[model samples]
Target chain A: MKFLVFLEHHGDALEKGGLGALGKAAALGEAVGVVLGEGASALAPGAGAFGASKVFASEDPALAPPLPQPRVDALAALVVQESPDAVLFGASVLSADVAAGLAARLEAGLNWDLTDLEVRDGELVGKRPALGDTVMVDVGWTDAPRLALVRSGALDPVESGGGAEVESFEFETSDFSTLATLVEQTQEESTGPSIEDADVIVAGGRGLGAPDKFTLLEELANALGGAVAATRAVVDAGWYPYATQVGQTGKTVSPKLYIAAGISGAIQHKVGMQGSGTIVAINKDPNAPIFDFCDLGVVGDLHEIVPKLTELVRAQRGS
Target chain B: MKIAVCVKQVPDATVHKKIDPATKRLDRFGEAALNPTDLNAVEEALRIKEAAGGEVVLVSLGPEKAVESLRKALAMGADRAVLVADEGAAGSDLLGTSRALAGALERVEADLVLFGQASSDGDGAVLWAAVADRLRRPLISQAASLEVGDGTITGKRQTEHGYDVISAPLPAVVAVSDAINEPRYPSLKGIMGAKTKPQETISLGDVGVDAGAAGEAGAKTTVLELGPPPSRGDSVKIEDDGSAAQKILDYVVERRLL
Candidate 1:
């Protein structure tokens, strides 16, 4: 019944999805947090607060940002030493690579991209949209170590009771191969707030003429205490970083409240964000594709609506 | 450079899928094919071979049916193909899968190993990196654009922030992305040529690997349960009337969506 969690981090602090994954680890017997790379201890208290019984870290300095395959190898080695019944990973790209790699190292099947999950018959049955959302796939590994990749925002991460015991296990050493060396890393500080943890997300699309016009989107995002997202076009134009792009080629986000402005919803975009708890779209084009998928569709100019809404929100918040 | 591309068969991404009541998962009933990404890797390997004059060996460890993908690789111009078929290898998890593939690769002398970012079904995208680890080689992943000249290689690696140029020495492992190149269709002559080509198959013992370490015991992740997809919601039918635009706008206001 043991559940092991892979805790993702942003420079020593736990990531939102990692918190979500930590919450998921609660159901699996004794929870262990497997962290990769340097400065995994800053996450120790956060991991304990989130619900890990023990945190295991690989403090390898050669590990690069984003590509966590080396960490996967370390986790696999850990699984060999401590055979947990289940492993859970956040559905972010870096975590997914680590999860899949660790799962391969363990010869386990993965229930991936799950928006919903439940334990039935002593098994974790995971569900995800498949085939353009045309069909649902329930993925579970019967004979292998139970592995689940839960999407961010799919589960609410609350205080997991005890700021539990933080036991640090020495990384069972192995001669690491193909050390994923980071030749370069470009990090753009997000404007408003971190979107993965944002309860509300304000998204823009090609309708916003220039990258600076994204300031208005940021204004709306600031008013809502949310993060600003952009479509594939915005990211392609290099107006926004790829992390802020919510679409097929970009990050798949499932925020609770999503407000899309001046955006056209392509199926690829819809696939990424349709899981939002609530969706509202604003665009001047009556037939803009976003209207089809959003819970609330506004056929108007975002330039007009966004500014007015920002004012309303600011007034409501007494900011 | 001796390059090996590990490919897997996947259900075409665009195929219509149905949920299997028995499995409670997306029922890809009968229409699984080689992962579209593998073809991209195959094409990339062909391009690399065309430029560098190295042999491209396509290797996959799956059931006997996996040869279909190997044939496609050969059709795509891979110089050779290998299928490692064993029942114990069946239902191999990511680690065991990578281990088995790595074992097979040990038998072949190669300078580079290539793989797609990931297979569509597992989408875990772990094999190439894991195999690279198992092979004890330098690894680079998510390369969207690649150029090989002399003893040096350069590729643009995709990241959530943006792409960064990666340089690696020879005898490196790389996983290519679908954006790298379009896989070409196998001409009739290529198809005919693949039939006459040779493919080597090896065993778990011969490759010098542990059997228990592979298959289920090697896996660390597991699927907990299967659930059907969320029910499709009521469609917001846009009325064809030209003036319905105003109604949509009003609906937008009522929801406080502005």
Candidate 2:
């Protein structure tokens, strides 16, 4: 099967999720990579290590901005030229828009938030979690050039030794596609690793008591060399930035250790972090559903326990 | 400035949602409510109408029961509502659903279209782009803050790294994030008035959609099987005393996580 994976990149660094999708596609069958933006061609060779057999690079000025419409036009043009059997993407804010627009533009079938993809009887099937991750549903496309958006961090990128053939492609952007202009872009000031990349995640919930209480999680996360996350309730309550939200609507993360403090272990929050290697729940409510799934459940007041835990971790690290 | 707000009826957040093994579909017979984020879309549209001096109309596609959810939005100060309810459109996927909704928007000739970033159920968060593509209009998604200007709309959306501010002309599609605004509760007076507001129901044909091109027949994807999620193994529970912190640290050390 010939699969085309959309490799999302910022400058020369390809997003890890896209690389993971590329690696999986390459493992399944012939995988080609499509890169768009100002220096897309420069990033093509790098995809080779991630299992891309060939790369199509587009350096159209219109596609330079991180907007979805222009990238959709470019991908649609490439789809017509290549006509690959399927197109894959690692779900992200920008990639989701591009995939959806491309699906609409090409009138192709699109499956989203998929956790896995496999071949069955020579047909591609997508595995998706539904109903708050209570069940896994097998999904299949009814047409060719099937489009899919894999959940972020669902697949891991593996470096396979090889070089890929890089080819430059040309595409046209419709006038309406360029109508939206980017006025400003700013990065949030943060330290340590992002939740997606952290090995340990210290997540706070309404149990944190207040917005400022998140600093306790920060201290714990810092002691453990981890990142801080928040439950949807706290984020929606404006106790934390939306970027740190961990739930159905926010980003899914799988870390080595997930420390949920004051979290009730709701189904929504569980779906996002259930994949963690070890889950530790610290809440005053012994009956919090999170304890049912957590590897280690602690019934206590987090405000006191978190600070004490941070001290122990720091002492253990001898820092 | 006529605005069209697309909304959905989802299983209540507290509900333990399940899929019927026979039909492989979400059993929607339980209690349901308007998707929480969609309320944000309705609220945003109402705000725009209050400022721009035009009507805010809600549009939805679902079983006939969905009108109850629409009424809730109507009670929030929307002028009217249109629901596309037909057996033929029962299992419509993103494409088919967008086609039907786009047709309704076309009929409305809305100056702006709004949607929640995604439904809590499907959570694909891409339907707005599809509708916008079908309408051949620009789309600005994940809008945390939106401003309707003379002929353009400026939306600020939070991104992974930070946020981006984007501008698109009128007659655009926008999907607002939950961070945008607080949805207002329907007052008793508004709830009573909503019953008199026009609530129209149409079919796939009325929206110029071929019946064969909607619902399950029009869906481009299908479910092959269903199973429970992988289980996490045995867990150990402990009551926190003075030593709870030390026990956790020991567990971490035992696993060599440190």
Top-lDDT structure, candidate number = 2
Off by over 4 Å in 2: A311-319, B253-258
The digit string of per-residue lDDT tens for model 2 on A1-319 reads 8899999986458988899899989988999999998779888899999999999998888887789999888889888888888999998889999898888888898999898899999999999988767788999999888999998777888999899999988887887899998988877878987787688999999998899999999999999999999998998888887788887778788788999999998877887888788999999998899998899999999999999999999999995
Model 1 Cα RMSD, 1 decimal: 4.8
lDDT of 1 at B22: 52
Tens digits of per-residue lDDT, candidate 1, B1-258, equal: 788888876665667555455534345446567876788888998998898787999888876767766898898788888778776765466667778888888877677788885565645555675676567666677888887857667777776545766767767788886667778999889999998888877777767767776655555444333444575365454432344334534554465543
Tens digits of per-residue lDDT for model 2, B22-96: 988888888899998899999999998888799999999999999988899999999999999999997788889
Per-candidate DockQ vs. reference: 0.29, 0.75
Best-performing candidate as measured by TM-score: 2
Instruction: Give the deviation of candidate 2 from the true structure as CA RMSD.
Output: 1.9
- Each prediction's RMSD over C-alphas, in Å, is 4.8, 1.9
